[model samples]
Target: MESLGIQHFGAFVLACIALALTPGLDTFYILARSGREGRTVGMAAVLGINAGCIVHTLAAVLGISAILMTSALAFAALKYLGAAYLVWVGLRMLLARQSARQPTVTRGRGLSAAFRQGMLTNVLNPKVALFFLAFLPQFVSMQAPHPQWGLAVLGVSFIGVGMLWSMVLAMLGGQVHRLLDARPHLGQWMDRACGTVLLGFGIRLAMQRQQ
Candidate 1:
């Protein structure tokens, strides 16, 4: 049993790393925002994402994710909520008008706001919850052992891997932000690009099948 658990843990680590590396809506949003807002905001976003991952882990452990996966109404409700949140974020970005002459505030209460944004971005996405529901269970051997414990460990591993990946992304985005800060037009373009990507994701999420 110990050997099996070790093997399962190893496989779970590999899978979590792969998932973390894969580009997703969260990645794009964080990268773009970090490039525009600076490392402080980017790190805040990463922290928020970690917080959301904790929620996902908890949901998986508590079987809430299974309820969401099996119930069409619950899934649809969450799906729409996620979609709406993304669209709202995009709209907010589109409406923002920052002047080039205004001094850039790299350090402010903005980090907290960015962190909250990151949390919402992940927490609202039903697909992420569903992904955990489906993916984590596949790793647990129901007949061989304690499936719940296996799932819990795998879920926590995924969150840890995701946080590591997001931090790397945030650092990269910060570098880009430094390069682009001198060019307000470039910053504006980045904002627009992020808004577009977010809007697209929201639309795509809305079109997803409830099942």
Candidate 2:
């Protein structure tokens, strides 16, 4: 029904697609996990990201993001927390030592660990919450009589579309997995590299200010 979300349908879809395609922390996380792990873990990670986005959508709908965005102190506080979380995750990865039976351990603890990490990574980003706060309202139709519903629709649409692209990225990790499967030692180095990338993202996020 048009009441659902027909206003600016073309524009909304375009905007959602553009944002989904844009490379960001989410993309990097999925790719990193997939390349390090495999499709199963990657898919779990994708689900975790979506689960985190669900919280963002709810926060935006409930106006929590509004509070964070409008208050400088609040924004900075959340930003730092997110940055710290990223750095901690990165450190954990880097400092983790692989034992001789690392492959067995990895196989033993697969999708669940990846899923939790993915969810935590997205939820702690705070920037994702801010992004939803800023981006979703643009496509919400005033004529919808219930702008909140319109916002919800836009948020869900973004999530669905975004997840589609994320899955593609996760699949691409399959290539990396195959490449490094033969070189077990390289996998350790690869995790360290991904850990470094996460640290970089944390530093970048820490330096961001409301614009």
Would you estimate the TM-scores of all the predictions?
Answer: 0.89, 0.90
| Root mean square deviation (Cα) for candidate 2 | 2.2
Off by over 4 Å in 2: 1-6, 99-108
Candidate 1 C-alpha error for residue 176, in Å = 0.9
TM match of model 2 to true structure: 0.90
User: Model 1, stretches more than 4 Å misplaced?
Assistant: 1-7, 102-109, 144-146
The whole-model lDDT of each prediction reads 0.79, 0.82
Q: Distance from true position, residue 158, model 1, in Å? A: 1.2
- lDDT per residue (tens digit) for residues 164-202 in model 1: 899899999999988886776776666667777888889
Task: Point to the candidate with the largest lDDT.
Answer: 2
Q: TM-score of model 1 relative to the true fold?
A: 0.89
